[model samples]
Target chain A: MPILIKDRSMVTPREAIAEGDFSIGSNVYRREKKVVSQVIGLVTIKDNFVSVVPLKGKYLPRVGDLVIGKVTDVSLSTWIVDIASPYPGVMRTSTSLARRFDPIKDKTRKIFDVGEVIVAKVFSFDRTRDPMLTVRSDNRGGGNSPYLGKLVGGRVIDVSPSKIPRLIGRRGSMISTIKHYTNCKMIVGQNGRVWFKGNNFEDELLVLRAIQKIDREAHTTGLTDRIKNFLEEAKKNMPTPSKEKQSDKEKRSEKKS
Target chain B: MAKNKEETVLITKDGIRHDGRKREDLREISFDVGVLDRADGSCLIQWGRNKILAAVYGPRELHPKHMQMPGQAYIRCEYRMATFSVPDRKSPAPKRREKEISKLLGEALNPALFTYLYPRSVIDVFIEVLQADGGTRCAAITAASLALADAGIPMRDLVTGVAAGNLSDKIVLDLDDVEDKEGLGDLPIAYLPNLEKVVLLQSDGIFTPDQYKEALDMLVPACKKIYQLQRKAITDKYSQINEAVQKDIEAEEKDKPAKDKKKAEDSKAKDDKKAKKADDGKKSKASDKEEKKKKGLKKSSKKKDDKKQASKEKEAKKD
Candidate 1:
C-alpha cells in the first residue's frame, strides 16, 4: 500500500499514484491494485483516498452548480444557454421566469433575449441530455433571494474552469477578500465566467487583473495572501473618486454582500 | 538486390552504418512540449532530421452531431506533411497515404485514452510533419501522444513509436531516409510501454520469420527507451514551473514574517518529505545502476545468440 510519488507532486497520465485497495477519487483510475493518474495534475492522497486535480480541462455540468451562461438562441419555450461546457444548458420559459406570460401574444424574446448573460442553477444534468437551467430566485440556497437572475451592467470574463476553485479560494476567503478590497459586487460561476461590477471602472479593472493573475498562478500554493497583498497595493495607487459617490457605491456593495 | 547492397555500402566491414552508427543504435530524439500557446496542447519532436508538430484540441462540442459517439468521445486525428518538407515538394493536398495514416494514428491513440468520460464530444489531434525523414509516422504518433497528455486529456498510457528495419540482410534498430528507401524491410510500431501492448503495427517490404521476430525484439526495447525520453520531457516542463513557484514562495517568505508561524509548520513537514525523497532517490539510483548492469549482460548474451544464428544459417546455406 505504498504511495509511488510525493503527495501534491505533479503527475502525468498513466503515472502510478499508489497501490492497494485505495478508494479512488476523480482524475484517477484503478488498474488492479495500482491507482494511476488519468490526467496531468497534482496528485493528492488523503487517508485512503487518492485523487488528482487536473490543471486544465473543460467544465463538466454537475447538478446544483451555480453557472453563468450566455443565451445563445431563444426558442418558443426553451432558451439555449451556453454554460461554457460541452453540452448547452436549456433554460425553459416555464421554469425560468417568475410570471406566467403567454408566448403567442408576446414573443419569448421579450423576457430573455439572445446573448443575455444569466446566472442560473443547473437543476438537472446527465450525459444523455443537455443540462437544465433554472433562473427562478427560489432555486438559489437562501429562500426568495435574487441569487439567480439575468446579470446586468457587469463585465463577464472567462477563466479556466479548473482554476475557478482557486479564484474562489478555501471557504470563499479569496472572493470575499477581492470583494472587500475593491468594493466590487462579484458573481463567480462554476463554469468559469466571472461577473463583476465595481464603484468605478478602475476598481472593476483591478478585480479583472486579480482574477487573471489567479488563473495564471493557480498551480502555486499560498496564492490567497499574494492576491490580497496585490489588491491592497493596486488600490493604493488609484485616484479616489468623490466622497459622496464612493460612499453611496460602498453602501450598495455592502448591502449586496 | 544483393549486388545493389554490395555497391551502396550501407553497412561497412567494421559493422558501422553509413551515418557511423552501430546496428543497435537509435537516432537522436528530442521533444519540445507545449510550444503552441493557442492550442490546448502542442509538442514539437525532432527525431534525427525528422521534425513533427502535434497539437490537441477539445473534448469539447462535437460538430455535425451525427458523428458524435453516444458512449465515448470521438478521436479525430489528421496527419499532414508540409509541401516543402521533402526534397521534392510534396503535394499540400491530403493524399490516400496521409488519410490512412491519420486514421491509423487516431485508432492507435484511442486505446491510450479514457474517451468514455466525455460523451458527445471530440478530441482532435492534428499532427503536421514539418521536416521529412524516415519513420515520420512513428515520430508523429510519439509527438501526438505528448500533445494529448499536455492538453490534460485523460489517458491510460502514453504511446511510443519506433521503426526497426532490415538493412542489407542485417537488422537495424532505427532506419533513416536512405535506408528506408533501399532497405529490405521496415516495421513501424506504436507501443504502450507501461501496458506492454502494441497499439499500432505496420510492416512494409519483406521479412523472413527470424527477421520478423528479431525486429519485434528490437522495436519493443527502442520504443521503451523513447518512452522514457517522452516522460522526462513532460516532467521537465512541469518541474520548471515548480522551480518558479518555489522561488516566488521563498521571496514572499523573506518579505513577510508574520505569516512565518503558519508556514513554519508547513515547511517542517516539507523538509521531512524532502529528506525522505532524498533517501528514496538514492535507493532508486542504486537499484537503477544494478538494473543497467543486468541489461548490459542480457544484451551481450543476445549478441552471442545472434552470432550463433548467423553461423547456423551459413552452414544451412552451404548444405
Candidate 2:
C-alpha cells in the first residue's frame, strides 16, 4: 500500500495520500480518493485543511506589505519601482505624497529621481494589473505615517522572502532584539529587502551579521534563541556606554557653539 | 542504416546487445538536485553518457501581458544542446529539432502542474544538454521535472522518460548515440508513472503493429523504473537538508545550556566582587576612626561568609 501522508507533513510529488483525509493545500490535488502532492515541501494540515510549505518560491505581492523599492522609471504622475519581485510596483503621485500637486505644475521628476530607494506600502494589487504602492501614511501613528518616505544613507540587503517571517519572529520579537542590541534602525520589506541604519559602522556590521545568520538558518528550529544568544554575546564586547555618551556630548557641544 | 549493420552487429543471436546488456536494460542513471543557487530549482542528470542540467524559475508574473492565462499559469520550456554535446560540434543556434522538442516537453509537463493555483504567472524550465549519447530529449524531460520539483513547483507526478528502439529486428531499450544513428526505428515516451498516463509519444521510422505494441509494453516498465530513481533523487536531497537542519538544532540546544550556565556564573562573580569592594571601602573609612574599626571588621567577616557560601555551591555542583 502506498503511504498516506497528512497535512503539515513533508511530502514529495506523486506521493499517494488519502483524499479528504488530508486538506487540499497548494501544489496538491485530489483525484478521486487519492491526494497527490505537487511540490517537495512540508505538509501543513490545519483544521482539516492541508497545504504544503514550499521550500523555494518567488515572492507574490500582497496589499499592506511594506517594501523597499528602487525607483526604476519616473513619469509625469507615476513612478515605477522595482520591489525585487517579478512584478514592478507603481506609485502614483497622489498616493505617494501627503500634499496634493498638479502633475502639470509640479515637476514629478524632481520629487523622486530614478535610482533612489524608498520604503513604501502596497496599497492595492490585482492579478490584472501591476501592484500599486503608497508612501502616504494611512493616518496611523509613527512608522506607519507618510513621513516614512525616502530612505537615506543606509545599505539595502536582500534575502529570500520566505525567510522574512522568521526574521520578524513571533510578534516582532526577533527584530526587536536585533534593534535593541545593535541600536540600528531596520526596515524589513516583505519583498526581501532590509534597510540597516546604525549609529556607527560597527553596529551596522553587527546587524548585517545577525541578518546573514538568520538567512542561513531560517529553515532550522530554535533560530530565535540562537540569534538572541548571538546578540547577547556580541553586546558584551561592544564599546562601553560611557564612551558613547562622551562622544554624544561632544557632538552636541560642537553644534551648540 | 543497412550499410552500418554489416559493419557491426547490434544484437547477438541470444539477444544481448553490443553494450553487453539485455534488450530491456536501461542506462545507468543518477540525479543531483539544487546544483544552482540562483535558480528557484535546479537538477543535474547523468544518464549513461548523456549529461543534462535543468533550471526552473518563476510561477511569478508572466511577461508580455497578452500571453497571461486568465485561469492558470503558463508553463514554458526551452531545450538546447551545447555545441560540444555531439561528436560533431552542434551549432550554437537553436535548431528546428530543438524547438520541436522544447514544445513537446512543455506540453508533457503541463499535465503534472497545478497551474490554476498561480494565475497570470509563468513557470519557466530551461534544459541544457551538456553531453548527448542518445535519448537527449528524454533525459532532458526527466531532469526538467526534477528541477521543477527542486524549485518547489507543484506537480501531480514527476515525468520520467525513456526511448525504445528497433535494432536487428528486436526492440531495445535506452538507445545510445550509436544505436540511435543506426537503428531502424525509435519510439520515445514520457509517462506519469503514478497517474498511469502517457503525456508524450513520438516515433521516427517504421514499426509493425505488433512491434509497436510490444514496445509500449517494454516502455511502460522502463519508465516506471526511471520514476523510482527520480523519486529517490528528490527524497535524498531533502533528507540531506533535513539532517543538516537537525544537526544545527541539536548543536544549538547543546550550546545553549553551557552559555546559560556561564552567564549565571559571571553574574554571581560580579555580585561577589561588588560586595568585596564595598567591604574594602568600609575598611578604609573605618581606619580614620578607631571606634568604627570593630563594625568594619564585622562587615568584612560577613563578606567572607558570602564568598564561602558561593564556593560551597560551586563544590556541590562539581561533585
Q: Which stretches of model 2 miss by more than 4 angstroms? A: A1-3, A6-8, A16-18, A21-27, A140-148, A237-257, B1-5, B60-71, B257-319
All models, DockQ values?
A: 0.27, 0.34
Per-residue accuracy of model 2 over A117-170 as CA lDDT, tens digit each: 999999899776778998888774545443458899979999878789989999
Candidate 1, overall lDDT? 0.88
What are the lDDT figures for the candidates, one per model?
0.88, 0.84
Identify the leading candidate in terms of DockQ.
Answer: 2
Candidate closest to the true structure, highest lDDT: 1
Tens digits of per-residue lDDT for model 1 on B80-195? 99998999999899999999999999999999999998999999999999998899999999999999999888999999999989887788988899899887889999999999
Runs of candidate 1 with Cα error greater than 4 angstroms are A139-146, A239-257, B1-7, B253-319
> What is the CAPRI rating of model 2's predicted complex?
acceptable
Question: What is the alpha-carbon RMSD of candidate 1 to the true structure?
Answer: 23.4
What's the number of clashes in each of the models?
Answer: 0, 9
Which ten-residue region of model 2 chain B has the weakest summed lDDT?
B284-293
